[model samples]
Target: MSPPTRRSPRSRPSPEAAEPNGTFDAATRQQIDAVVAALHELYPDADCELAWETPLDLLIATILSAQSTDARVNQVTRDLFSRYRTASDYADADVAELEEEIRSTGFYRQKAKNLIGAGEILRDRFAGEVPRTIDELTEVPGAARKTANVVLGTAYGIPSGFVVDTHVKRLAHRLGLSAETRPEKIESDLMARIPRDEWIFAAHALIWHGRRVCHARRPQCGDCGLADHCPRNGL
Candidate 1:
């Protein structure tokens, strides 16, 4: 009889990795709390990185942020916003020129089209003012919770909820506070776990952590303050 199929030694770790031995112990809970406290104190002034001068600017900047870095969006919008001030300006903008202006942000064609379309909607439907409510904002072209959140929070001083992007999703998963990978699911998990008062800042802290320490790839676990508490599972 043929010898039993030999399994590679490396495969032995798979079971160990998935096993939930001590997923959330008391110590882990304490550490999670402490980590959040540290971040709150460390980044009290945590704000959205996108630069904008007005509510409309913020709306435009956020619209330009899809699949793009905040820094890049800011860079592009610096000049873009000056040239196009109001909804009418964007709505009537020459598509090719608008595309060229935001080319650096990636997906410029789609972004420009969305911007123009959203601008037209704002002009026709809402009198050119960025809406303060979630449902109204989402009705615009290319506006989702992430974009609407920026407008509601930064533009209207309303807590629309957390802005969960790639950074937040990865960081939340690595931090063991959430098992879900999708941004919406992760946002829901975070909202359920965190205090409503901290919703705005929690996203900022997570973003800062994701960018600085808990990166999507090769997170610096050794230096991370929450490393001890981190499950680092499925990461």
Candidate 2:
């Protein structure tokens, strides 16, 4: 009889690589809450890193932040904000010039167009003031649920929903808080687990955690305070 074929150890999956699409049960909820509490303790004063004084500023900055860093967006907005003080200013801005100003952020053409269109909507539809509600804000160009959440929660002190940026998405999966891939679904799962009052704070804390410890390429699991609680998904 032929000897049984042996399987290579490389064929076996590692613990982190064998992560399940986690479920949100009662016990899962408790774990999630504990994770949130731990994150809050770790990052007690987490807040939006974007630099903005007004709702419109935050709205524009969030849009620019799509494929760029907050620091880069702030650098561009430093002069951009001063130049365009109101919706009318952006609405009247020369597209080519605006694109040139923000060219370093990448996808400058689309961003400029979105900014101009957003300004027009704010000027024509909302009377030159950034809308307060999520529905209204999402109607503007480049202001999706994530962007609207940032604007409403950070600028207006209204916790419309959690801001699911790349950081939030990554952390949510790693922490086993949500298994869903889409931001909207992940957000729904989070909303169910996290209290409405902590929605904004939770988002900020998760973002900070992702940036500082749970990095995309190599999460600092050794130093992470939440390592014990984290599933270390996709590690």
The positional error of residue 155 in candidate 2, measured at the CA in angstroms, is: 0.7
Prediction 1 global C-alpha lDDT: 0.75
Error of 1 at 135 (Å): 0.5
- Best-matching candidate per lDDT: 2
Q: Which pairs of residues collide in model 1?
A: none
Stretches of candidate 2 above 4 Å error?
A: 1-26
State residue 147's C-alpha deviation in candidate 2, in Å. Answer: 0.5
**lDDT agreement of model 2 with the native:** 0.81
91-160 per-residue lDDT for model 2 (tens digits): 9999999999999888999999999999999999999999987778888988888888888888878977
Among these predictions, the greatest TM-score belongs to 2
Lowest summed lDDT across 10 adjacent residues in model 1 is found at 6-15
For residue 71, model 1's alpha carbon misses the true position, in angstroms, by 1.4
